[model samples]
Target: MTDSTAFDWRSFLLKWSGEWADSLPESETRDADDEAARQARWLGFPPASEERIAAMEERLGRQLPPSYREFLKVSDGWRNAGGFVWLLAGTGDARWHNNESGLADMYAEHLDEDSGPEERREADLWRRGLQLDVESDVTYVLMDPEDVDDDGEWAVYTWSSWRAEPPERHANFLAFMRDMHREFHSLGARQGDTGPVFANDTTRELDARVEEARLAALGGGWEQAEKALDEAKGYSRPRAAGLGDQIRRLLGKTYMVYFEDLVTDPRYTPELLPPLVAEHARHTNWDDATLRFQLRGADDELMSLAFETLDQVRNGTYRYTPAGPFGEAVDRARELARWGGSDAAWRTLMDALPLWEPLGPDHLAPLAWVADPVLGQLLTPERGRELLSTPRAGRTGTPPSPAANLDPGGLAWLAEPDRGNNRTSYRFVLVEGVHPEELPGRLTDAGGDGGGGMNGDADVHGADTVLNAPMTLWDARHTSTADQREFSSYDDRALVAVGRAGTDWSFAFDDRPAPFHRPRFVSPAAAAGVGTRAMVVWSGLRPGHRKPFFHLSMAEDGAERYAFTYEGGEIRRSGEIPEALEPTRFFGDLAEGAAAEAERPLLEAVTREFGASLPRHALTSGRLHTFTTRSWTRPPGQGETYTVVRRDPPPAQWTTGGHP
Candidate 1:
């Protein structure tokens, strides 16, 4: 079966296995004794003989520990139904496995219309939760690109939707993403603030500032003066004397916005801007636009963190109480949900309030997601009416527009008037972050008083729908940014600029499941620092009495792969791989692993763009692959900007029709 969504594995595995296992009945429930007997069979005691165990191990190319091989016989039927199992070709660790619908496509290659008993028996290992070797659907992997930790802790491995952003499994992934984002934020945040942040009043401010700056320029022909502008670049600066000086004011404004101390400082030089010019920042407005544009962008960057925090409050995703960034945003979101906005938006806000608060016995924050099915519960039928009833935030505000002067009190205030009555509409963005997949056939299905922008058409169209149905995961992971507003002000069907698809996939601690893998996706440096060193190795496949057991480890670079195998239970470094083991097959076994390692560095803005289904006309999605590491946590003294994508390509450009 081909499972279109790769992200569904966790839910699918737990759900399908729990149900399937529950269906099986025990013969007598004496598992302890039965386990021993089963091991005896597998180990070839009477049912299993030492000679049989030795012969079986020989065929597999390795000897099994008496304890491990014994336990396999009594294995608990099956509880897992996805990842790393006996499939047609590759024996897991690297190849892809399609469950729902994709599984049908691959299996069709080896089997007839139906699977036989032997196929079913082989499949049982997966269902019963047997060993999970890595699978090749690796999104990305990598070793530390810089300093190699001799202790071997610097490396990261991660995977996600292919459609998602590129994978980034490297030695220093966690540290790397953070290092990159800080600079990304410091510089990019200004772009949104000055250019297009969805702040309180975009149009009015832009218009007002533009006019003021222009007038100042027209009057002062040769005099330099400082002024701010809201139009175009989004900020104002002191114009130098003369007409030429006035026009370049916004450029100066942007410079100051990016490096606050630079322009404002008593002694700053024009040389600071030279670097930008060399990087193709034409005319200087580049500094202004890039800086402010990214402030709003931060919203997008942090939205996932916010949803994750909210999810924890919603789903209890972790065992320990998480005091992470997700927690902070929930507190902020709850505050936003309670905020009563201009007349029209109030109802939507109030209706979404319940989804805002905490609930469920597990106290998991995500259970509120269950309420998403019945969005109708969020509305009060009088919310839109109520916005009009509440007094404005700070009086003295202008009425929405001469047309919407429906504000009989004349004390009306709308967030934006630029698109007033034009095809565009505005609403306080935060309410319920509706996932597109979760959207009902119609807006009313969620909680519509009838027109909160639902055009009543069978097919949904235009920018208007976003106000009524905002999505968290869809909105969060669907776009990329230097800051959070990119997510907050997101109006299009965006693609996320995740360092890697996400922080979900990880490296196992000791090849055992308990402390299986730390859920935290960290930097390669941290990974190597974590203590356990599970190497890549399998032995005894060749003749001349090669070692039969192998242990795993890596060199400083994590590039040249090596293993330590066993000869009579003693560990020895066997630098060379066995002759019998095919190099292609060996790499195939670790297809998942190597891919994960290779993808580490590329994850910055490559992964996390997966599974994004958007209309062609709305937006052109793309990746910011030129991420140059920059963050407060990283060592000072930069080689290249961590946030800046390709120096030449710039990575700011996008593609249409879902082209990569």
Candidate 2:
């Protein structure tokens, strides 16, 4: 690390110029009349003479801070210190902030009784501090003489109107400037722009250090590599930022690295992305970090490759063979995978990660098995908890468990009383051997509305009349809208949304109240006509109902195979129950407890028996094709009692085609 006392302002400003010039808009560069095109733009003004510096200090009746004084001796003032700061004031222009702008008084008037002591202190300092920035966008840079360190270095602050509460404070002027430099690089990177490279000693040295770090990582000197990359990033080197991210991913700080100019370079993509994509596939929820791979401007072919790899993983066809020093440990994992010990294989690979080293800067071995077709499925909620609960090399504490974030497959979400909208009631129909695309139309027909106006001609009445028309599957925008209304129940006119569960199974979600709430009302004919097995599951815990109820009805080929409804600690069973229900004690005498206690276990047993699962996201946040059903009309009597159980049923004022 370089000494702060002997900081090289000239070299730092030189690097700042390179970044500034590169970030200038193309239109500005094209116009000769633009200030950036007229002269040596972004370069600092000539150094202030000692006499001038002394005169300014004498006028202010205070000695200037050492770092700021040295900075003026090198460059009187700088243009474009960072993207947010347009210019720094020179000796001739610098003044006390209060003298020019009475911002302290303005802020004081707004302060209330709730304002804390820190806020008051900050407001007072705003009046006394020496302002450094002459031009900026709602941003101020000031040095406070009252808050000096032992070395006479004044505290520096960068404040912006958009920020909340306290401004960012740094130990000294040098620290503040360094942070600004880093911000410039981060801003550029986020905009998908890598600032122009300068072939100066400073940049050349940083680039060399990056290369050395790569070599160190390749040779298993991971700690050394991490240190070098960390140092390089302090200078805001774009390549170092990308490489540092990669090291963090490998060292377990994160599960993936994002796409960046350097990280996604053809030289690195082949090694870096395969394992990252694999890690992504293992996740139940695609959080922002994992979803960034599909952002605009990402490599198209790489994304295609990621999707194809995921398909292979799901189909149990993807394979990987580790090479070099990592080969032995990874091969052991592969053996475990082949022997059907998938969870063991994942644990084995995770255990060897600390010792495994990259074969080359562009070669990431061993980790590719994370995307291995069979092994990827091994990262269940249980394994995720285990991985997160254990501290890894170089990590300070146990990592946060992603277990809760992991998708609890099948009907697991039903047991969570506070899940999406917290309506305390859920009804869904699961069908096997039906394509997701075909379910909406089939469900429409089953609702007995002559295909629910899928041809766009059937009369429909609801908040979203367009539901009668076909829509694209996985409508992300609509899903996002639904997710935002977390506290509001679905309107009475709401219908069903369909999504795929497994390779050959589809499920429908209905959030409306009864008599539309029953899965039987939605019709089993849809599943039977297609000669596929289907199951309808319903559970309600709304207060004041005669009893909280759990219902399951299974149908195969136009016939009811088995059915049961458990309410108020009583269960009614009919037809031939599957053997899977026996282990769950579904038919045993009721225990003296709440019926809700047995709901989850029964749902799990049914899910296992039918080999069906619905992604929680599909119901909570994911968008799916929607359809309106003829649920408004009562079906002809089928020799079974139909009851409207909700205390707040649809208003009698609403017509239901003369059916009551």
Candidate 3:
């Protein structure tokens, strides 16, 4: 790290010339005249004569700042100061910005009472500041004489139109120039130019420090590694920036910074980006959690690319093939996943993690494991932490079993199987005497348009049309309303798949099956027509726990007939308990035990009595008409909140079954 106060201008300019000479490709260079001048002044021209400098100072009526004066003595002017700057002005070309630019007047018009102190200073300085850059790509570099420090160094400012705020301030000219040099190296690295940016000794020292940090991080000395890497980054060590980010991620300080860099790198894009995107979708699209660090800086083009790539991954059109033994492990894991053995698949991957080598310095093998399609879904936060903590050798144990098949006939596979982790909370609205085709229109305020939907099947139309209408309605509702407080309250938007069960039954399945404070039940007025009936069944349980609080509601002829809730070994009934519901019959051997065991029984009884049986194949493997339900348009009434007054003693059945 060179001290900015003692900056050596000649030596720095010499180093800059070596780095910038071939940093950019031929096509990226300026026109012939500009290129020739840039080459001629690459290391800067001869020193400015003291007589000539004094004459220029007299002409401008102001003495040059110490740093700029010393810089001019070493080089009259510099070329290609950085990626954006073309040339620095010598003593002859330097003058007050007000003499040649109207930027001050333009900025003055935008100032108001709300303008901050920094903004006011920026506007005032633009007119009186000494302009230094002769040419740039819409960038202005200036030195403010009024903002001098005790050392007599004027504060430097760099203003660019692309920035959102006022000009950025630097402590001195040396600081500004150092930043520009780092920018050149950063841009060069991104454009596939990985040449050395510093002297041989400096480069060797930084590289050695970065390698030590890497080893320290792998050895669980993350705090020490992070400190060393951060220090190296100040000298513009490219590997230091990446390794520092990896350390931060390992420490859980950031979520996607390292992965974000990997996705933009072409070397890892094919092998890693897809799984990373899939993992991001699992958190954003499927999980109940709000969107986090996924695609934080992505523009429209990148978002589109990610969305398309995810769709391909989900549809089995895209596959990631790792190299060596890791590829064989992934292949076996994927095969096991195909056969519904999620636990076994995850175990296989975990077993192979120790032998897996990252494709490049930027790659983290553990991230690839947690982001995998088959293995990622089964991984818990604890498991992810373990993987990140020990990147080379992940901990292994007996993983939880895959989600239990809830379909009555055991034929229904999940449409989005990755969501199976959340199957403990399930909800679906069942309607009698409504066709699957007609059900979407009744459930949503907007009628269906016969068009293909997001499921990638043209014939499956109503789901997309129905769901799209509600999003428009929600947007309009929030936009048109005076009170926007309820906007976030209407987060009940859900993906629903509509399919015919038996001859007389049709059901709409909520893809966000997780139970909430208010279940997104179809409005009785919409589902129950002249002679039709609608029923909603929900079970909210934690994974690996059988003590679910079950809810069943039935309505007929636009009137709710009965509601039954079984929770904490007690049954809360409204209206009347139907004779058809015989808990003892379904419970069978466990009839005398805890009510926690009643979930499966209740589901079985409801399936038998209502004749509600959705097609497993249609809901999973085959495409069915699906729509997104906008619960905001017709917000459902908050259902009853039950108090578990009766706490049953632990039953031997629950103990033997390992259910809590």
Candidate 4:
């Protein structure tokens, strides 16, 4: 007997196909239990024992397929479909069919050895392969052992009894059953049936409807979501009960979106509270201890007290709704904010934006309702003054390029002075000491004799060796600062000067007045006081489009710092690095400087490029690897860049078929 782990058709029928049958209308389905009992009445009904199967195989001089063998273990022969579907032969029947050519009598008659040459030739081929079921109506249902794929998986064919030529083929028995099942359902549907004869229960459909409702609610279409849930309730009472829990969870998420929006918006008003509070209470038994639930039914005085209570958004002492410790509410908002460019990219932002407007110039009070302390302080009037007093960072000698025409609205809004004068400013600086022990002098040395490139090297040295040397910051092309028709420009000479100076270097500027700004000072002390030491290095502005190129600051550090806007641009530093970033140190053998924790993003980029998780041990273990690649836009070898790899060799840099 095959172990249960191997296969048991009995369980499979009851669990999979049986379950599907149970879901169908009574008129079109059979219960598996009843089928089993009926099958027991047939001769050899207890299912062939393993010894019987083995003895049959011995006589046939061939092994049965795994799926078929597994099926026989559970059922010697099935009495399914009143025996009309097909009569499966057991061990005893196997010999009579094979030796007596029982298949030939049923299907080989179609071959007709006396047929015309062409037809006869094709018929002979079918005769050689066809294995017919004794009980099937159409000889079409048969297995063609001669028609096997490279994997030795025989194809099953359905043929017309009148013609012995090619028959329609299915890849295997499983596929044949699936198509048959589908045909059965489709036939029933066409015959005025209410549902598919072989269809599974409404679980799949129910799950889909539930997901749709949740998404609708998240996107603020609450009415549509409610309607969806009501419709879902009709699928099945039992299933609907389970879905009720999911609906509540979704409702909870929806409430949080609105709750945080009301709490954060500086232009909040008492008028918005009634609808939100009322809806939350109606949807769930939330915050019963506080006035939250009461406020839902509150008259003027009660409503006023509710407002006063909720106004203190950060109060942690109260035992309210089952949904406790609402700090995760803000976390969820931030998660939504980070959904950049995905399908739901703008969902939360759009949902929350209308809840509260920004405080106008005349409005200066801190939004005490904001539970997040950092966010609350940023909205204060005094903070706005301090931001304005700060000097912007960026070099100003060059004229604004013609390409800088587009007003950087959203991007510029990020740098507003009143919101935080320094908020609009950006900074770019040189991270000291983070260099490979030995940089590759020549590109050829990294790649093997094939001379393509380093196949893969798991070491800091290997990575640096492959890295394309950066263009000098002071190069005339980069530093010209000329008003060219195209805004494609780089000022490498200044960077080279900073690199040579040996001190920490950076550029900072608030983009309040302009989308692009020049650095006002090169002093490190000034960089230190501006809240964050990071800087934005403009790659260039595209003419007509007026699109400014940039790289996010914290996202790049160490060797990645050498990367520029064209390669991977930098963005302004926002907030302080939780800890001082250690510059990349260049030591000969034990060269040691950790990639800043702030630069984990750069590490993540490496991981993504390699298509795997890059464990910290791989890098720290000194088994890191590297691959060198060049930009197609630049001259061959000119734009060479070495990237780090871990555990495995880096992917080759050649087009398929060996074309470079």
Please name the candidate that would achieve the greatest TM-score relative to the true structure: 2
lDDT of 4 by residue, 177-219 (tens): 4455444333433333575443344445545776666454333
TM-scores for all candidates: the values are 0.15, 0.50, 0.44, 0.26
Q: For model 2, how does the per-residue alpha-carbon lDDT over 1-660 read when each residue is reduced to its tens digit?
A: 325558998888777776556565554434432365224644587899999999999988899988888889988987666677777888988888873566687668878999998778778878899999898988889899898988789999888877764678999998888887767655654554333333445556777998887655544455676788787776666566566665565445554355344535666555555656655655734453444543334577866766676665544356665555446767786554432334455667667655554434544223454455434444444553344343333333433333343346666666766544545677777778875545554454333442233333322333223333222223322432342322121223226666566556776666544533333444444343357777777777444456777777778776777777766666677788877775238535555445566667777887777777766543554333466443433354544333332323343232222123
In model 2, how large is the Cα lDDT of residue 181?
75
Compared with the true structure, the alpha-carbon lDDT of candidate 1 equals: 0.26
- What lDDT does the true structure give each of the candidates? 0.26, 0.60, 0.59, 0.34
Instruction: Determine the backbone clash count of candidate 1.
Output: 152
lDDT of 1 at 80: 16
**Residues 481-567, model 3: lDDT tens digits:** 333222233335445666555657777765444344434334333343436888876666333444545667788887777876655
After superposition on all CA atoms, what RMSD does each candidate show versus the true structure?
Answer: 36.9, 12.1, 16.7, 24.4
For residues 27-125, write the lDDT of model 1, one tens digit per residue: 435355334433332211122354555565564454342222332232312211122111111111222222322323333456555879655533322
Question: Cα miss at 339, model 4 (Å)?
Answer: 42
Location of the lowest summed lDDT over 10 successive residues in candidate 2: 485-494
Model 3 off-target regions past 4 Å?
A: 18-42, 45-66, 146-153, 160-169, 183-217, 220-271, 275-309, 312-362, 369-660
lDDT of 1 at 17: 31
